[model samples]
Target: MATPNTAATPTFMVFATLRDDTDFAEFAALREDEQKQLEVLRSQGRIGAHYVSPARRATFVEVVAADEAEVAETLATLPFARFFDAEVYPTTPPDPAEIAHRARA
Candidate 1:
């Protein structure tokens, strides 16, 4: 049986950057395939918002997952996974009580 995961599950921001030596043609082809996969993941509620850097060299993708491992797994499915450096940052909602306390201070 699999061990239960008791840790907090959270959303994440995924940062991915193409390698400097990446082949443009190959990258374009892989990127097109990756986009199709992303659409499917989005429909499944695994992926959320997405953005591109102003220079269009890097991408930021939001993912809803159980942990960093899940985020990594999701990224590994991307066609460019082997050709890019990626990082995942977990996120949490701010406490409303804290916000109210700060407002009263």
Candidate 2:
């Protein structure tokens, strides 16, 4: 089964990995700033979901936006933008059964 996509609401998936030259001190300093920014986005109903990778060093975020430019603008607000390499993918919901089958495989 194919999942439906709404033209009015576009979804984006962000995968962020720590850069080799990331400075821990600067990263720590920006944590509070990023958290505050995320809170504002959340309040605005922009963020769909967010999670840290199992390894604890990476982050994955799902956002709702009008277009790619909006997604890029939102991501640019993150304080750690310079410290991470990020990939942004346009996404849609997947079938639950297919996801379960993949898990079983």
Candidate 3:
């Protein structure tokens, strides 16, 4: 089960799948705007890594917010918001020390 987000646990992973009926032409038209908005979020530290798979029509974003609602709000700012069906999962970033230990093991 996913843990609830709190002040100390504000990171979230969002998986957004593109709707089947989404118009690709329209999405292409707004690509520039989407890129700009994503840049703004990154600059503000509201978003971290963003990965997209055009073949799978999916996007994964790392978000920093107070809760799921805030995460949703942040995503809604995207030009492609209407075209996505998103699932938000609260996350705790992996510990670097733990990763190093596991790697050495």
**Most TM-score-accurate candidate:** 3
lDDT, residue 18, model 3: 98
lDDT of 3 by residue, 1-105 (tens): 222222444688899999999999999999999999999887666776799998999999988787788888889899989999999998875467533533443
Model 1 spans > 4 angstroms off:
1-9, 54-56, 94-105
Which pairs of residues collide in candidate 1?
none
TM-score winner between 1 and 3, please give it.
Answer: 3
Instruction: List model 1 lDDT by residue over 1-105, tens digit each.
Output: 111212333568898887889898887777779889889777665676788884867889977677788888877777877877888888774256533533443
Candidate 3 Cα errors over 4 Å, as ranges: 1-9, 93-105
Candidate 2 lDDT over 1-105, as tens digits, reads 111223345678889898888889988988999999898776665665899874867999877677778877778877877887889999875457534633443
Q: After superposition, how far is residue 35 of candidate 2 from its true place, in Å?
A: 0.6
Better of 1 and 3 by lDDT: 3
Q: In candidate 2, how many Å is residue 54 off?
A: 5.9
Q: What is the RMSD, in Å, between candidate 3 and the native fold over all Cα?
A: 6.7
Q: Is candidate 2 or candidate 3 better by lDDT?
A: 3
What is the Å distance of residue 11 in model 1 from its true position? 0.3
